[model samples]
Target: GAGVSQSPRYKVAKRGQDVALRCDPISGHVSLFWYQQALGQGPEFLTYFQNEAQLDKSGLPSDRFFAERPEGSVSTLKIQRTQQEDSAVYLCASSLSFSPGMDEQFFGPGTRLTVL
Candidate 1:
């Protein structure tokens, strides 16, 4: 079975541009999550989805961030009005269960976003 995967491993954007990142989770996984990591910092949770339902998005830094899992497997994270402060690695993870703290999350190689 395939593990989580992300696209466009690297991106360079000018400030104020918008970017979209994609994620493909392992088959049959029930939960998906997005995270943001600044340089030299640990990844911070950004949002969570159970199947196709978005359950939490409290960690998104601002309204510029958005995420969705419309079909319960593939997910997307969109960042609008990119800022230099938003330059970082965006990670995607998936688990077999919805219990975030208990279930082991499999992480994909992150997509590094650079805002010039």
Candidate 2:
């Protein structure tokens, strides 16, 4: 892909339902990241991957969330038992550099997940 792309740009999930959002990053990018943004707030990092290696998942709010990049290019973020607090815009970004200290991430438009 030429840039990061996320599917289901808008999603409405019933409370306690499970949802999966997908991201396709730019070609040959070495770093991928996921973030969550509640309305009126800045993005908060959820996880980061260096190629296929998940380096950080410190920002995921709870055990119900999981993410993977099985092939180092496309990624999925799955939320189980979604709560109203889970409603937010999920963003995916990719960078040419794997290192956090040097990478310049390019972000997608984001998937807006709403839990009711």
Candidate 3:
């Protein structure tokens, strides 16, 4: 894809359910980031992957939230034991270089996860 692509644009998960959201970034991008946005709030950083290495995950809300970029192009964010508070939009963004904050990050449409 020429741009970042996220699968399952919308997802409904029952309480305690597990969900995995996928992200396919623009080819050859060097940085990928995962974020969670609650209702009306801004996106909060969840993790960051530079190439195939997960260099930062300090923003993950809990142990139940996990993300990975195995091949440096595609990534997945997995949520375990879904709860009402977990209902939010999971966003994926990719940048051309390692400095995502300074580079222009191409964002996906995001995967909205609704936990009921």
Candidate 4:
């Protein structure tokens, strides 16, 4: 019955650094999502997974952004060649189902990344 969780609450990276962020969704949840929140902006959807299958990745900014959920519960988001523009908060959310109208998503505290 644990809630969604993310690791490395904060990260400081130099330009061109590669970083990996982790997320652990609530147990038995069927849907997981990743979002990016830039300063003073609302969170933007990055990708989504239904179980182990990545159903949508249209929101990923570039090839440098990658996400995976191999076993359906834990996920990782990786960014390569970090830039100052990439500094933002990464959030993870999970829902009991993938239905947009039925399930409510629980969000993690988010990981703040600062690229210098």
- lDDT to native, each model: 0.95, 0.94, 0.93, 0.97
Ten residues in a row with the worst lDDT in model 1?
96-105
Q: Please list the residue runs of candidate 1 whose C-alpha ends up more than 4 Å from where it truly belongs after superposition.
A: none
- Top-scoring candidate (lDDT): 4
Error of 2 at 110 (Å): 0.2
lDDT by residue (1-116, candidate 1, tens digit) is 67899998999999999999999999999999999999999999999999999999999999999998999999999999999999999999999997637689999999999999
Instruction: Return the number of clashes found in candidate 1.
Output: 0
Order of models, best TM-score first: 4, 1, 2, 3
Cα misplacement distance, residue 24 of candidate 2 (Å):
0.4
CA displacement after TM-score superposition, residue 10 of candidate 4 (Å): 0.3
Task: Report lDDT (Cα) of residue 15, candidate 4.
Answer: 100
Per-residue alpha-carbon lDDT of model 3 for 1-116, expressed as tens digits?
47899999999999999999999999999999999999999999999999999999999989999898888889999999999999999999999997525889899999999999
Candidate 3 wrongly placed segments (more than 4 Å): 99-101
**TM-score for all models, in order of appearance:** 0.96, 0.95, 0.95, 0.97
User: Model 2: per-residue lDDT, tens digit, 1-116?
Assistant: 36788998999999999999999988899899999999999999999999999999999999999999998989999999999999999999999986538778899999999999
Q: Superposing every Cα of model 3 onto the true structure, what RMSD results?
A: 1.4
What overall lDDT, based on C-alpha atoms, would model 4 receive against the true structure? 0.97
